[model samples]
Target: MRVPDWIDETRISYDAVAGSYADMLRGRLAEEPFQRGILGLFAELVRGGGPVADVGCGSGRITGFLAGVGLEVFGIDLSPVMVEVARRDLPGLRFEVGSMTALDLADGSLGGVLAWFSLIHVPDGEVPGVLAEFRRVLRPGGVVLIGFHAGAGVRHLTEGYGGHPMNVYVHRRSAAQVAGWLGEAGFTVEGELVHRPDPKTEGAFVFARR
Candidate 1:
């Protein structure tokens, strides 16, 4: 399949900052009580469902956390460098280079899919297709946990993590808009959590079932 220019840009940008991004975010879960709690809830929802896939899993921090919580989990990232970092950092877990828009998993193969702050890289026009892919890879009653910045519009970053020069777009979406998209993609919205982590960004978590 032909990859989009933005996807290529995201992969290259992340590869350039993989190590620094890992270093900055590796222990971040410890500081966010709400996010950790949500992950715990997600693990419980899909505990006996089947194996889970952490899509767009950068450096595997969340993947490792999910594994530590006793859910069978693996990770996939768009950036090969990020996948390498994740593999090196979390040797016990599995990590691979892949895309969320076109996952390489069999239909109805996954019990749950986690997109923690990862879907923000996907442009608005392509978000539905990505959600459809999520629905396709999930079994009946499978759950999907999506974390994103809540609001509207996109922000361009010229430099990120450790002051590295990079090209990336951070898309902020409303919770209601995301819920509608999930519904359109054949997912039943279960619950949503919204919190203002900072003045500049609102964190949103949507839990849905297939």
Candidate 2:
């Protein structure tokens, strides 16, 4: 099968910025109380159910956090360089090169799936397919947590992460729109948290179950 152009572009962009990106976001999770709270609730809900897959786990920050909270989690990302950075930064954890459009996972093998601010790169037309993959890998009642920029339209990012050249499109979406996609993919919407730290940034977390 032919890979999508956006996937290649996204992967290349992340690969170029992986190291600086890791450096920039490292240890910052401790400062975000709301994000920590959402992740904490997710961990509690899926703890002991089974292993979790942190899909699109750029540099494995969330993966490490979830592991620290006692969930058996592994990281997967579209960029091999990102995976390498994650592995080097968190040597004790497992990280792999993979894509959310087609996760390299077994059906019903996961208790939870996390896509923290990673789905922003996925186009709207491909979201349902990605959500379907999430549902396929998760067991019945398995939980899925997704964080995305909450708004509408796409932003073409030509330069990012310390001025590295990039060819990526960041898609902003509404909570209700994402909830509808989850519903179509067979996930029961569980909760939605919209966070606006400032006028320029509007993010959201939508968690659901299979």
lDDT, candidate 1, 85-128, per-residue tens = 99999999999899998899999999999999999989999999
Evaluate residue 50 in candidate 2 and report its C-alpha lDDT on the 0 to 100 scale.
Answer: 97
Candidate 1, lDDT over the whole model: 0.94
lDDT of each: 0.94, 0.94
Residue pairs clashing in model 2 are none
Model 2: lDDT of residue 81 = 97
Once superposed on the true structure, which residue ranges of model 1 sit more than 4 Å away at CA?
none
For candidate 1, what is the TM-score?
A: 0.98
TM-score of each: 0.98, 0.98
Predict model 2's lDDT versus the native: 0.94
